[model samples]
Target: MFATRSEAGDRLAAELEGRGVEADVVLGIPRGALPVARPVADALEADLDVVVARKLGAPNNPELALGAVASDGSVWYNDALIDRLDVSDDYLEEIRAEEAQNAREKADRYRDSPGLPDLEGERVLVVDDGVATGATATACLRQVRAADADYVGLAVPVGSPQSVADLEAEADEVIALETPENFRAVGQFYREFGQVTDEEAIAYLEGLGGRS
Candidate 1:
């Protein structure tokens, strides 16, 4: 288990180097992932940025995700789960719209502007602290694709085997340090999975400008 997010980021960055992965930019899914992504950007010598996506929680169990929407309105829906849960289209649309706007506002706040980085023809690496359901990661991947990134990759310190397998289809390459067979939750793998405040997350992004 990683002692801290920074340690996980360092290991993930080392893994990417061993795999010969190179990126023009690294986009971290805030606010937990920013700490992890900072070390990755430093290691790869790439520009760091935020890729905002918010999970659309279930009506009854808000902790459970129905889907997710990115800042650019790119969405990833769990159709089977939604159908099984008998969620209505109207309800889904309502949550999707709300979450999309939330994601947009978050992206704007992190960037300090509405403008996103130019990713056309550039290799993009999308980093997250870890993947559980992978709903948000899917949305973020779609958003990166929408930006016309020449290559889109995913990097995480650890993940469930199923989630890692599923993400292989979405990203050009996926670098997961560990995929435990009996994974319960993302936090289970980390010794110190503390919450990252918005100010702390923003500072990581702001520091990237000096590197570029």
Candidate 2:
């Protein structure tokens, strides 16, 4: 297991290099993935930025994600799960609008600006600390696609095998260091899985300047 998120980032960077993956830019999911994405962007000599997406949790069970909405209102839903839960269109629309605005606000906070990078025709690599259900990551991928990214890849330290498999259909490529069959959670794979503060996450992005 990795000692910390920074260590995980280092190893992930090396793995991407070893695989000869090239990216024009690296977009980290805010609050957790920025630290990991920083090193990868540095290693790849690519621009670093944030790609924000919020999970649309169930009505009663907020932890259970029905889908996710990105900053740009791009969405990815688990149709089978939503159908099984009998979630109404009105409810879905409500949550989507709420989460999309939340994502946009978070992205603005992280970037410290209202402007977003031009992603059209760029090779974008979306990074996260790890993937659990992949609902948010799927939304992030859809957002990147909506931005007209020529190629979109996902990079993570570890993830569940099933989640990785599901994400393969969303991303043009997936680079995960470990995909354990017995995966319980993303934190379980890290020895020091402390919460990353907003300040710290934004600092990583600030260090990248306007490269993105």
Candidate 2 stretches with Cα past 4 Å from truth are 208-212
Writing each residue's lDDT as its tens digit, candidate 2 over 1-212 gives: 88888888899999999999999999999888987998899999999999999999998998999989999998988899999999999999999999999999998997756635898999999999999999999999998988899999999999999999999999999999999988999999888888888878878887732111
Native-to-model Cα distance after best TM-score fit, residue 181 in candidate 2, in Å: 0.7
lDDT of every predicted structure (CA atoms)? 0.91, 0.90
Error of 2 at 9 (Å): 0.3
- Give the per-residue lDDT of model 1 (tens digit) for 38-111: 99998999999999999999998988999899999999999999999999999999999999999998888888
- Candidate 1: worst 10 consecutive residues by lDDT? 203-212
Clashing residue pairs, backbone N/CA/C < 3 A, model 1: none
